[model samples]
Target chain A: MSSFEFTFWTIVGCGLVTWLSRIISFILLKKFRLPTSVIEFLSFVPIVIMSALWFESLFHQNLGHLPQVDVGNMLASLPAILTAILTKNLLWIVIIGILSLALIRLVI
Target chain B: MDDVLDARTGLKDTLPTVFGYIGIGLAFGIVGKASGLSPLLVALMSAITYGGSAQFVMVSMLVSHSTLLSIILAVFLVNARMILMSMTVAPYFRQERTWHVVLIGSLLTDETFALSMNKLNRTQNTLSFPWFNTANLTAYFTWIIASLIGALLGNFITDPKRFGLDFALVAMFIGLLYLQIIADQSMKKALQLTVVLVTCILMYIGLIFIPSNFLVLVVTLLSCGLGMVIKHVLF
Candidate 1:
């Protein structure tokens, strides 16, 4: 009755939505053997949208005040970014990023 | 992978990425563990949801005392990217049996996206769907093992304030962005600018005011419409 109920029932709702998204493909591909060109175009959908989401999450914070930049957040993140680029390794990124933050007190 | 690659290409194509997955997956697992949830729960969510950002969002929401509505809003918005991913694959999948698509879709995660995108870009003919399973299995195993380790030792590990762990996620994204931008210039510009603009809007405007999930909805609908318009007008 009340909206405040902490029911995990929401999982059922989300699962239903997720299921329907892929259901059509299963139906069509099995029965009709859908065309190849259609599949090729549809394949781009994930990467393009992911690129969008990635952009939104990463640059959204830094965009408005760019050029002059706020020293506070940028300083904390720079080490992790630099290490990841240089080493191309995850352990290095985590370590370098955390150490850079510990030393962040010295910067600001 | 065996027949597809020669002996020489083995060192170059597969090893580095697989090694990196071990570490990245671990970072993700431990982060989930540190969120105070059980590792079993984390594994289940990671396996079923198959979404990296949503996993992080769920953990962060748990930490920040977020309302269930807010958590759903954020995740729903975050998972909106999947719509674009699905739509792109939808038309072609019409032939595959339903359970097959469902089996693979449920395991679709970031690594799966990367592997599949690269494979599709290269191949010219009908793809064996098992490649999707290979990619998903690799990512799933890594996330599961790493998270269990992270969960058990989660309390003991030393680090910055919770703020630092938060920074770790941001830094990881930045590094990934830099690599991506280098590979494709126009895409990089679009993505980097998108990242900056969205972050600024969400941080300042706060997701509560505007339906932040609307960003995904708006962009996807616009892109789909543009595709339709181009098909009608240009072709």
Candidate 2:
């Protein structure tokens, strides 16, 4: 297929997958009243998921054993994590994280 | 009071998102353009795709002339978190049309998702479009504007490692996770332990197939689901 075909299908397929993942839960949830305990815990689900995701990227690696710790990793990750924690703002969080990583790499 | 927030409020919330997206998008644009996309086209893609990591992948793939299926698979994997995110926010949008929900889901990103989930958790009332759309629009605009700027003034970013900017995203995510736990201590402890344990186990397993971008998300999600079931049975 042509590049255009690929891009088009990519968009269409992704939109479908994304929509299905998102919309399915809503449809399913409508049929049953989830237990209150489940609901409460579910609320925290994102917190768990997001943290795991960010942690992996910050500390882990693409080509190695159990996330070998590098100085750059810590320097890039620590300050960014701190900024996100302290301010609770996305803009600042991203900026600070990127900045911190960049600075450490630049300086040391 | 029941139907209080609307476009105006949405517009207000959206402005910050737009600004944030624009600033960050500029960086992406520079990177993307240098990698290949014409600056203008990169800006266009930023507006259309309206996602951070996905756009990053798309530009790389497009530059390498990757197959359509390959690009889709890569993006699909990277954005799998959106599935969980969409599921989280789905309950709040039953009143809207289905197409609207799908389109909105396409617009979903880490920042907006974080904001929307918090808003929903705080209020038990039915959802509305204004605030939701407003917040999304803000982030979307920000990405477009930022990409435009970055593309226009492309430059090889100097050693970013020195400023420790690379750590910001991890830090931001950590901060967000910590805040969530603050609302309920048990969940907090459970999440913390789950993150640590899961990371240790995954690292021990040495699975490099999955992208690092997805680690915390996948493990934390699986563990949280397990934790929820355990909590359900115990109490």
Q: Pick the candidate with the highest lDDT.
A: 2
Give per-residue CA lDDT, model 1, range A1-108, as digits (tens): 112123233333343444444344444445555465554334334433444343344334333343233344467666766785787654466556656655674556
Instruction: Give the CAPRI class of candidate 1.
Output: incorrect
Estimate the lDDT of model 2. 0.60
Cα deviation of B30, candidate 1, in Å: 3.8
lDDT of 1 by residue, B9-122 (tens): 323322333533444445666776666666666665555554556667666766676776776666666676555555545444456666767666665554445444444433
Q: Each model's TM-score?
A: 0.58, 0.74
Report the C-alpha lDDT of model 2 over B145-233, residue by residue, as the tens digit: 77787777777553323344335445555655555555334444654555446544653344355555445456656666666665566
- List the RMSD of every prediction in angstroms: 7.2, 4.6
The per-prediction i-RMS, to one decimal, reads 6.8, 4.1
lDDT of 2 at B43: 65
DockQ leader: 2
Instruction: Tell me the lDDT of model 2 at A35.
Output: 71
